[model samples]
Target: MRVVIAGGHGKIALLLARSLTSAGDEVAALIRNPEHAADVRAAGAEPILFDVENTATDRLLAVVTGSDAVVFAAGAGQGSGVARKYTVDSGGSVRLAEAAEQVGTQRFLQISTMGAGQPPARGSDKVWAAYIDAKTQAENDLRARNLNWTILRPGRLIDTAGTGLVTLAPPPVGRGDVPRADVAAVLTALLPAAHTFGMTVELVSGSTPISQAIAQLSD
Candidate 1:
């Protein structure tokens, strides 16, 4: 399958690209920085330079054209401010979904925060408030699109190695941490899962094997 990933230079995106490529799938990474081309290439993905934050939706058509799926994995980065959250995370996500629909791409995947649907209370912090609001708004917008969408809301993301296991389900759980590589693994595992469509899965580190966990997903 041909997959297009926004924010292809991101850690998770890069890991996902490698996994997809290793599985013999055609992978394309959409990135804003040309300097990151080599890094994306090293991961065995074709890199497409595009700026979803500033570019028109039409400008993204070529990237998603004929692709099997579109993954909205872009973010404003760690040190970015509140405004950037709305632009890159919120606006970029909505635009990716819009572009996917416009290009007739049927599958859309989104990487979201664990508590976005019900963000934590951060009193008086405009930046945190904006971030949560952006994620919440983006998720809502994606749900309204005419596509097979799967939203993975992961717990605190860590840089530890993957355990090849995870706890995937609907909400009502407390906080926890999940390795970035594990998240990427789950993302790859769900790539062709029709059962994951229309599902917003909550993920965290656990003892269940990836395959076993994904197998329990309800249609």
Candidate 2:
């Protein structure tokens, strides 16, 4: 399969690209920084320099055209301010979805976060609130589209090595930390799952192996 990943330079995106390529699938990663090209290429993906935040929808459409699937992994980054949360996380996702819809791309996997639609806790900083709000909007927008979309909301992300085991279920899967590698593993597993269409799942470390966890979701 050929897949296009927005924010191709992200940790999860890079891991995912490598995993897919190792499996003999083609990956095109959209990145804004020209300097990140070598890194993305090193991960076995063709790097397409496109900034989801400022690029036109038609331009994005060109990038997504003829792709089997699209994954939205772009973000405003840790040091970015509140406004960017909306522009990059929420707006970028909408732009990609519009392009996917126009091109008749059927499969879209959105990388979201836990607590996306829930009310922000008291004492939460403005940026944290904005991040959650942005993800919420993105999830809502994807759900409203006619595409075959699956939203994976993973719990607090850690950089530890993946265990290949996880708890995947429709929400209130509760709070926990999951390795970025494990999250990538789950995303890879979800690509060909027809039963995951329209499903929104939360992931965190647990006993079930990745394949078994995914199969249980279908069951």
Candidate 3:
């Protein structure tokens, strides 16, 4: 399969790209920085210099045209202010979904934050409120589209090695942390499964096998 990742330079995206390449699949890593090209290529994928925050939808379609699927791993990054939260997260995701639909890309996967749908307490940090607003809006936009979309909301992300185990469930769960590698593992495992279509999954590190945890989500 040929897959395009929006935030190809991100830790999880790089892990996913390497995993796909190791599985003998083609990967197109969409990166905004030209300097990240070598790093993406080192991850066993070709890097396409494209900025989701500034690129037009038509241009994005051109980049993703002929790809088997797309993954929205792009983010405004940690410590970014409110305006960018909308521009790069919510706005970026909606634009990609629109471009994906126009280009006939059938599958799109979203990497979202866990507290998105359920925003933090009122008068919380304005930036965080905006972040949740962006993420929630992005999720809503995907659900409104006529596309095969899966949203994965992972808790606080850590850089530890994957344990190959996790807790996968629906929303309103206790907060926790999961290794970025395990999140990538879950994303890969769900790609080929039909049941995951239109599903919003919540994930955190745990003891269940990745496959088993995914199946349990369906049950």
Largest TM-score belongs to which candidate?
Answer: 2
**TM-scores of all candidate predictions against the true structure:** 0.96, 0.99, 0.97
Q: How do these models rank on TM-score, best leading?
A: 2, 3, 1
Model 3: residues >4 Å from true position, as ranges? Answer: none
Report the C-alpha displacement of residue 127, candidate 2, in angstroms.
0.3
The clash numbers for all candidates, in the given order, read 0, 0, 0
Q: In candidate 3, which residue pairs get closer than 3 Å at backbone N, Cα or C atoms, i.e. clash?
A: none
Q: What tens-digit string does per-residue lDDT give for candidate 3 at 59-106? A: 888988998888999999988999999998999899989988988998
Give the lDDT of residue 54 in candidate 3: 88
Predicted candidate 2 versus true structure: per-residue lDDT over 34-132, tens digit per residue: 999999999999999998988877788888999999999999999999999999999999999989999999999999999998988988999999999
Query: Highest lDDT among the candidates is held by which one?
Result: 2
Worst 10 residues of 1 by lDDT: 118-127
- Model 2 regions more than 4 Å off: none
Provide the lDDT at 71 for model 3: 94
**Which lDDT value does model 1 have at 127?**
81
